[model samples]
Target: MGAAQETRTFVVWDYLVFAGMLLSSAAIGLYYACRRTGPQTQKDFLMGGQKMTAVPVALSLTSSFMSAITILGIPTEIYRFGAIFTMYGFSYVIMVVVTSEVFLPVFYKLGITSTYEYLELRFNRFIRLCGTFLFILQTILYIGVVIYAPALALNQATGFNLWGTIIATGVICTFYSSMGGFKAVVWIHVFQVGIKIAGFLSVIIQGTVVQGGITNILNDSYHGGRLNFWDFNPNPLQRYTFWTIIIGGSITWLTIYGINPAQVQRYNACKNRFQAKLSLYINLIGCWAILTFTTLCGLVLYSRYHDCDPWTAKKISAPDQLMPYLVMDILQDFPGLPGLFVACVYSATLSTVSASVNALAAVTISDIVRPYCPSLSEKTLYWLCKVTSWLFGAICIGMAAVASLMGALLQMVLTIFGVIGGPLLGLFSLGILVPFANSVGAFVGLTTGFAIALWVGIGAQLYPPLPERSLALSLNTDGCNLTSFHLKGNWTTTKGTFSPNAFQDHSAERTALMDNWYSLSFLYFSTVGMLVTIFVGIIVSLLTGGRKQSIDGRFLLTKEDFLSNFDYFKKENHISNQQLDMIEDGEAKTSELSQPITLSTQSV
Candidate 1:
């Protein structure tokens, strides 16, 4: 093990390449900071003065949530399970269609800073607060996972200190995010996506070459059962069936692309509605490209290790480290290539962490702080936003310590998103899609849905499905030379074996219904939570006298509106010219009435 690890150690050129990536990122932040002319307003700091273009915003949107999870976890998932995970590309298509047609128009018309502000406009402040709190919790948890993922990869590959990598990532991300705000984050995303793509391409190109050809890789995967994609099983308990991947995957991406503040803020930052819609469409293509790259990486990994299973052979500690291990194994002879891949992983981490930090700052100021301290000055709020970014960075770094204990990077991230994001998605959907949903129903439904989803998610984590239930593809270590390898004492390769005693013998105490509920696949967590929230919300609303007050048409998107042309700025079938005029007048009034809190020099 020591000799094999020594072969992959980072040399001088490798360190130079890695350092160059970090310095370039920090320099971008500094460049943006130097461009600031005076005390920045919330619009400038948080919204990029609403002058962002389509392509950059689209790239930023892609990189924001894709993060280290997609870079590392998706490939790992594909390797462990099969290519059925590639069905997620279809979900991205569904997500973009729904987001562009339904959610974007309402949000663009309303011109809100924080996505949760729409909750207050449509429901009440309490619901808005609930939505805000859920977003904060979800983002912080997700960012922790993102920060920890590449740290684990680097630690496994090059023996970098795990906590040290986490701290370095958090500090660098915080520096740019707090200093330059939204503009810096978006521009850095554009930069990082290039590096990420390069890194992924390197792995695929080299792996394919090493395997003789793409056809050979495909043939190996097909024979090894890693080319699976045709499972049409309707069982929700099945981890990666066709039904779960499409339906469950759609809802999962919807929560992120549709209503999540981190995403919505990018749309809101666009120059106009056209640019915003264009960005989402462009993001769809970018997402598909990324999914394809990562999925191919998995197939390549499978092809390379078809005979000598790394995990079974004890070449790596965890599945997430597979990509890094492959990179080190194949690219060691190429100077600076390993460091470039490391930069690629950290680049993903930076884009995601910076975006989350900026979004967290935006929401804190718009949803939490501004509501209570409406009198705070713009200059004060600007500095406050910076401080909040730094604070959240620290909190997320601390949360990274806890994320290490979570089972797998991909599953844990999706679980966090489903448990928290599903109900939040439902809350937003109830307000926009269901016109009659009242504040009472919205609050009750969100809370209840969250509680139940958390319970099921936790239960699923605690009592995982049996080995046979997951139906993992077979692996073999027959080709491995066991004599030269020094295996860890605790590592055991138990294949195709199950003991009734593996789990506590509580079958008699647990009912079948309870067992099925707890054993449901993680993919369906979002669908279950979303359906529960919408169903319960509607029922509760009707029971308590639904929609007593007349709601602004702007807050609601009817079926006709959803089907109509996407031109929202003009008078259309959905919103009349009079209503459009009212919206414009309201915007003007809001601008005129808005005032920054001020004090006399003496008071200061």
Candidate 2:
């Protein structure tokens, strides 16, 4: 409120809370590290000896998927755009079904350490290598973004150095993951999930109390058009339509949760196949719950600054800073609450980076290195895993630093993911759905898909065409009562509305290729990439002397997984018919013995 309050520094209590989180995380690592006798081999290091419990694995999956970016970006998106992005909650239903029934079953049954290993089983080592390379690249590129999200926000909110925050978070996470291995990664996630929930709940509860109540928050948000998300538009360029969010979000999540090793590695670590599926459900539910809470926070933010946009007032430099700005505004007098919020952000970042480092290490060891050195000693392999983990952590830190200079590079890399993801995901889908698909077809599809995706992804990025924006929500701070909330600040709200397209003219010129490729919404990137991969793959498979015989039945999805009763009946009826035929043949032989045999003897 005042200058002194504005320049408030984190007190001892604040540092204590933050230090406690770091210590606990490091403690977990130390505990697991001391248990060298427990998981002494590569399998144990990567998959926790395949004896992990369902609940912890579930929590790990949820936390890993909801990175710092998602935690900060979701609320910022909803605040800037509208609540339409909340439809991602509904998209989880489709994601859960596909992963559980289709992807998880195949991967679990195969008992593979890396998701890319399934590519080798279904296709060849080359395809497996390609998939692994793409995965590692995507994860590495993404970790930078994840680390930067919190560091950037913290820098703007509190005078903490951005690079210092990034390095500290990255190094701490890497140490835990490298030493503690898979167990540490999962358990740390469990702890991090708790922190994330507390942070979200605190903001939600405090904001509601400050803004009169839930009833007023909803009324204000509704009138301001911040609560809208029911558009059924089929347009691909439309960002948050039901079709785009459900279809696109489903595909995006499928790649992240279903095929991505960061997630599937947890599935393999579970005690059994059923436990893995249960964890999937748990993760889905947790994801929905977190999104709902965060979305509510977004609405409250809109209510708080309805008339005074943070960007317009220069109260905050970026939308991501709004969360921290809100925290300091409301809880500056409360001492350690601000620190808890930063810890929450850091917790999310740690969970994500740790899981990624562990996963990348697992893939590097199991998919890439181990295959080349099959006879390596177990102890050597275990150490190699740890080394790989640290290597990736260091690489991620470097990438985070580079990300600042390469602004749109993150968007470009993410676009490349859709280009790479569709084919990668489709390769797995082909293995599950199309029995006639051979290794050659899968390989061809993967390469072709990657090439097409690269062309489109890169072309679009180079062209830099702007797509139509989603619906706009107007904000008004005219009804805001700051004094009643016991706050006095130099900052005040402006009544003018913010327009996303204010700078771009509607009649601006566009290149043909830009409209065709660059203008394509990122939401549909994965879906299109997937379709191209499958189409090219199937056609190539057919053209190249298609599969002559059936491959492994386990690789294919069937009625048995979904319709147990139908499979049972089909097996029973087939067995019964075979028995009846045998009986009839025996009866015919007996009849010949009685009469027809006598005639045959006379003829002989």
Candidate 3:
């Protein structure tokens, strides 16, 4: 065991493989930087000249949100909780469908840069500013989590310096994102996603072979209670049940795919509406593929250590470290494979952070900065955009240092999204779907929803659910060879300490109001905030004499637009290729205008 531990440290081959990925990413940024024909315009820098195709954009969409959080956290979630985590795949399918049908058409037709621009068109500047603030907050905090997750995992498994990895990731991502702009970010996503998949596959294929085969893995997991797919418990307080996984998961992801600025920017960059929609469908496949791979990787981890659970055996301190530890434990004999997996994890980080940085720059320029400084030159605005990317990168690095103190990367991220993203999603949905939603309603609804959600989220964090409520499956340490591991006196190993029925007897002891509030599953935070916002926004609007002013039909998704999107083969109903060209051309000609021109009155 000691000899094997010695061999697990990163070697020269590992460093080389990791460095190669960084250099390749940097080179792609440089290529895009040098390839510019002249002074880059706002459209070129922020929108990729509105000429991006379906496939790379689709891949970029996939990579943008697939961050190290999913790579590291999802597997650990399954390992500890059960296979019920895989139920999120159904949520992804729902998210993509709602995004394509409901949200995409309104944004696509308006031909805008920042998505918050729609809020202003539909309501008022105050609403736009509020929406912009929420998005920026949500993204910056989420980037902090993304940057911190893999660094902590690698630090635990390989003795890598944690702060050093965080700084390196932030700096490299900032450099390329600031230099190459949106084109560079999208292409870098395309490049890194391949490496990310390769890294995931290496572990899955190698581990599956080592664990006998798929059947053996399934059998082992099934017997151990890890294959818990049919948990139909209706209690919202219970985590990972079918209702929470499907309903809560769908709303949580919709905040990202449907309304988040990071994703909306990607849709705005496509060549046309059809390609944008196609990119989303392709992204659906990519998301499901990665979800399956990570879920299987969790099962593989269980099969390898089912008899001697690492957390129970004191091999690692936290669940997030399991994947990295497994990689080092099993792949050490294969020289560069461990390094490839590390590269893969960081690749996910780079893709996510770069996309956030780029999206941040766009919103700062379009939503916040430009509205006040409409007279700023195009040249000045372009430079400001790049500088904003750098500024946000620095902020994310500082926040990453803070994220180390937060517990459980996956829940922390989703909680951040729910607390902020839910209200933003509600605000947008209210505007796009409700014709009578006024500025007063928008402002009051957003603030009230945000306050309540923050209270619930913070309360839940301060007083986490009891261990008995969200019990881990049974684990055994009987197979552990204590003689091979130097143990601390305080560390004790027990069999069957955690099981399905172990904690049920203690559930009735908690009855306080705050305790009940805190016990609500983290999955429902988004739903809570969103429902409050929509319900409150409607009530406020009706009370305030809703919508006294006329609204542009282009800003709302009406019945005709909703039904026409389903008529897939209707040539006239779709945005014609010629019309798309005109829209792009009009955007270029009107680039200097304070507000973008509404090119076509027709629905996308």
Highest lDDT scorer: 3
Task: Give the lDDT ranking, best first.
Answer: 3, 1, 2
- Scored against the true structure, residue 441 in model 3 reaches a CA lDDT of 91
Instruction: Give model 3 RMSD, 1 decimal.
Output: 5.2
Worst 10 residues of 1 by lDDT: 494-503
In the range 1-604, model 1's lDDT, one tens digit per residue, is 2234234577888889888999899999989989889768988889898778789999999888668888888888888799999888788889999998889878876777888888888888888888998899999999988888778767767868778889999999999999988999999999998888888988999999999999999999999998898899898888899899899899998988899888999987876666778899999999999999999999999998888887767666677777887887778889898888899999999998998899899999998898788799999999999999999999999998767667678888899999999999899999999988998899889988999899998887767666666888899877765322322222233221112123334554655644698778888899888988999999999888886757877788855457642334443434456644544433222222222122221221
Which stretches in model 3 have alpha-carbon errors above 4 Å? 1-7, 482-511, 565-604
Poorly placed runs, candidate 2 (over 4 Å): 1-5, 405-417, 459-468, 475-508, 564-604
Candidate 3, residues 1-604, lDDT tens digits: the string is 3222233578889989999999999889989999898777877889898778778899999998789998998888888888999888899999998999899978876778888888888887888888998898888889988998788778767767778999999999999999998999999999999899999999999998988999999999999899998888898888789999899999999999898878988976786666778889999999999899999999998898888787777766666777987898778889999999999999999999999999999999998888888789889999999899999999999998767667687888999988898888999999999988888998999999999889988877766777656766787876766413322111233221212223233435555744578778888999999999999999999899896756667678877568864332234235455544554443322222213344321221
Total backbone clashes of model 2? 4
Ten-residue stretch with the least lDDT total in model 3: 489-498
Number of clashes recorded per candidate: 0, 4, 0
Q: Rank by TM-score, descending?
A: 3, 1, 2
What's the TM-score of each model vs. the native? 0.90, 0.86, 0.91
Q: Alpha carbon lDDT of residue 486, candidate 2?
A: 17
